[model samples]
Target chain A: MTQSVAMTINGRRREDHVEPRLLLVHYLREVAGLTGTHIACDTSQCGACTVLIDGEAVKSCSVFTVQANGRQVTTIEGLAEDGVLHPVQQAFWNEHGLQCGFCTPGFIMAAAYLLKQNPSPTDEEIERGLEGNLCRCTGYENIRKAVRSASQAMNGTAAEPSAQLVGSAAAPVED
Target chain B: MITAPFEYARPGSVDETQSLLNKYGSDAKVIAGGQSLIPLMRLRLSQPTALIDIQGIPGLNEVRRDNGSVEIGALVRHVDIQRNAMLRESLPILVEMSNDVGDNQVRNLGTIGGVIAHGDAAGDYNAAALMLDAEIITNKRRHQARDFYRDIFTTALEHDEVVTAVRFPVSTGRFAYTKFRRRLYDWAIAGVAVQETGSSWRVGYVNLATTPRRGSAVEAALAGGASAADAAAQSGSDIDPTSDVRATAEYKRHLTQVLTVRTLQKATMAA
Candidate 1:
């Protein structure tokens, strides 16, 4: 029950024979071997498996790999170019946005998509835009700050995020 | 959670899609955005033997005006409807309803035709379609909004019938949709949709019964010169709603009245 699927992932074409039932999250993590996309919930309630399909944010776990055939996908791993962090990735780093880091990829991808559509989003717009991504730690205060910072960077208005903003990680790594 | 194994088909045409439906019969399911069906499949609530992906079908995603109505192809995603300037100008209620559908990701990939075809009682589009008096166009023929929905999660679409588009008469009056949910992205416990046509109001309720309910009694009351509160007070009398995890039957009935009033007032204000 496997079909040949060919699509561009992380700006590179990837082809594989996969099951029709294989979720896109598994395709990105297993077949494509990009593990930054985490799967926290199989029910699609959690946004941990979010990614960009044709430049729009979507829940990869809810999308079948076969459904994404011949489409372009951008995972969290695809955000950075060469050795430099994407503005979103750097904002999360400098703003102490990651709590456990398990949900970091999903948050970053959602925020990136948000900024793509609204480069100068208001706080309410940011809250509404990123409401799909949940953060059990940081109470989403720092995550909201990170998205604001990223918006400023994407809009080319802000200098480097202040070093003082990176006071402490939101939550300790469980491992 | 992985879905049960199923054969897949990407039909390029409506005839091909219907033929695939005929080939697979009742065992096959046609998927548009896969927003609702995919989650159900992953949870094993729906396990079709074959999935016919209709995203590749040609000319099934256009949103254009025809005659005096706006025709929306089945593959028109929520975001598409939400962002279309023409639709925004002509049918802002639809845009408002689409905006309230789900979070950003859901709206991006979820199709208008898919949700309408799903016929979920709590789905926002059903109430919109009901209030708008939309025409559900399928491969076979057009089904009137009042005749399209059979029950909760049921529609007039046969196993092999493919919904091609929906036609909504161009609206030229105030419209509003209000949903009451536990969270921003959750399904509505009870929702209200109000649309004005000429001198009368067309009202509909979501999740208040097995099918999306029209506020016939409320519409009658409004037509009889009743105030918004008085019209909305008749809301609970027109439909039946059951208790669920979201709320008690009494609470849903209460919400039905309150949301109906709020939507009517908002719609009036917009007028």
Candidate 2:
């Protein structure tokens, strides 16, 4: 009942002997220890378990681990690189897009996939694109703002990051 | 919840797949996109002893146009169908209908063959396929779309038969599909599809019955020169729908008429 599956996760190759019944969501969270991909509804109704399978977003909860054998999977944990956040993640942080933070990873992953498909989407297009990923805490206005900001950031219009020395005497006080 | 334990095999060829099917018989289920099957399995509605994954089979995912028809391979995903340039130019109704399927995530993995074989009554592609007079090509033989469905979630597919592709004749006339649902991603409570077949219109209703229902009375009224409103009013005359949790039989019937009128008007304007 167990099958050997070989897949590249978040850019690294992984091999696991998983049950044929093991869902991709569980596989990503448990075996790979990529707990960033949350499983809120276990069911496919919620996009909390969304991930990029071969660069296309799909519901990992609905996909079996065996079905993803020899494929590439990118989880939410894979979004940041070299201690820097992905543009989508940075947008979410800068715009105060998330209230609960439970749905942020899934939303960021979904937004990443959406912006890839549409670089400069209209307001209606952004609504239709992220309709699959639900945010119960935030009424989606801030999430929509984050997605638009991320789109602008990814298009190279945003200002570059500035490096500032820490612990300086003139440093601003923390909130 | 996890799926029931099952043996898994990914056959690389159609013949190999058929042999596995013949060996496992009805205890085995063929999984293409696994969009519908995986959900049912997780819900325990289906617990097959063996799952034959056909997604690895080669050459079953291509969309080619031949003669006067467009031949779509069984593994053609909904997103591919919607984005296919050839299909968009030759038959855009299929693309339009594909756009209304499950959300972007679902469409990325859900395939035409998977949807057709699952044959849910409320499925968006069922009535569209029926209206287009599509032909389902299986490894064993070909099946007309009209003869494909037997009942709710049932199809004419044999245990060992594998659906290879579907052939749809190129349609040059107008077509429109309207699906009524409570939410954006929910399945249709009732749907109306209008496709011009030669000199007459073919109207098909979804979720109005246990099987895909042809609005024969509506089509006939239209052929007799009745207005769209009158023809749409006749939509409830030809089909038998049940009162399910989704809607009352009366409500479904009412939706059928109203959606039929809206769909007919859209199709007519396109024509």
Candidate 3:
């Protein structure tokens, strides 16, 4: 009743025997032990379970594990390189985009895909792009600011390191 | 909620997929994007004994123009249709419809063929295919979009047939698709699509009935030079709206006319 699946998650090859009905989110959380991809909503309505499948942001909860065979998945844990943070993750810290931080990982991953699609999204475009994810804490203003700041950082227009130093996340932030 | 256990197979060719379908018959479900099917399976709303995963099938994901038709492969995902430069140029309204489908995550995994095959009334592309006079091409034959729907979540597709592609005639006129949703991303409570094909007009209604309904009377009135508001008033001629959790029956009819007028006005403005 189980299917063998081979996929690359966060740059590591993983092979597992999973049920045909086992969702990718369950496999990522229970089997792979990468729990950063939260399941805020089991239904695909919320993007809290979003991850990159072959560089496209998709709701992991809706995707079956066997469907991801031979594909590369990038979760929230994959955002950092060695000891440095991804620009979007750094921007979240700089902008204080989280309160309880439960939805932060999903927001960062969704924003990463947003920036990849539109590196310099306008304020309105950012809202439209991230409509899939919801932050129940009403931290949308900070989330929007974080995404905008991430766009600047990724596009190399971020404020000087002194301003970035104000953030708790340390610098030489890039790998 | 977890889905009931089922046997799964990924077939690489349409012929092989058809064979699997023949074996499984009504017990097997062909899964492409799995956006709708997976959700249904998880809720146990539908429990098929077998699943023929057709994602591995090749050649059903390309969008091309051939012999006066814009042929979109069935496996073409919504996001790709929304972003396809060729489609954006030749069949822009289809692209616009895809943009309004669901959230980005849903669009990433949902395929056009799956949506057309699933045949949800509230789905945007259903109305688009009808309004644009697209053809639903299957492994066996071609079907006019006008005769595609049977009822709610029902279509003209046979149990063993697979939708290989949809061919749309190149649009030569302006269009406006107006839909009203309760939430920012909810399914359309009521929607109206008006397309002016240069020589004639086509109007299709969404969620106004058991299936995607064509505003034939409204189109007729418009062709006879009726004003947009007057033509939109004819939208309710054939549709007997039903009350659902989204809106009251009267409210849905009201929205149909209101959105019809809005879409017609928008299309006129574009003209």
Cα deviation of A125 in candidate 2 (Å)?
0.9
TM-score of each: 0.96, 0.95, 0.96
Per residue, candidate 2 scores C-alpha lDDT tens digits across B117-156 of 8988777777777877899999999999989989989899
Docking class of 2: medium
Off by more than 4 A, model 2? A159-175
lDDT of 3 by residue, A1-175 (tens): 9889999999999999988889999999999999989988787887889999999999998999999999999999898886567888888887899888888888889899999999999998998898888888989999999899888877778888724553446554432
Per-residue CA lDDT of model 1 for A8-85, tens digit only, reads: 998999889999999999989988889999988777776889999999999998899999999999998888776457
> Across residues B1-271, which tens digit of lDDT does each residue of candidate 3 receive?
8999888889989999999999987889999989999989989999998899999888999999977789999999989998899888788778878887878888899999998999988788888888777899998999999899888899999989999999998875788887688655668888888788876789988878888888889999999989888988888884767998878999888788888888888887986
Question: Worst lDDT window (10 residues) for model 1 chain B?
Answer: B262-271
Flag clash pairs in model 1.
none
Q: What is the lDDT of residue A119 in candidate 3?
A: 98
Give the Cα lDDT of each candidate.
Answer: 0.87, 0.86, 0.87
Docking class of 1: medium
What is the descending lDDT order? 1, 3, 2
Tens digit of per-residue lDDT, candidate 1, span B156-269: 989999889989888868888888887788888888888898889999888889999889999999999999989889987877999888879998888888888898888878
Question: Which of candidates 1 and 3 is the stronger one according to DockQ?
Answer: 1
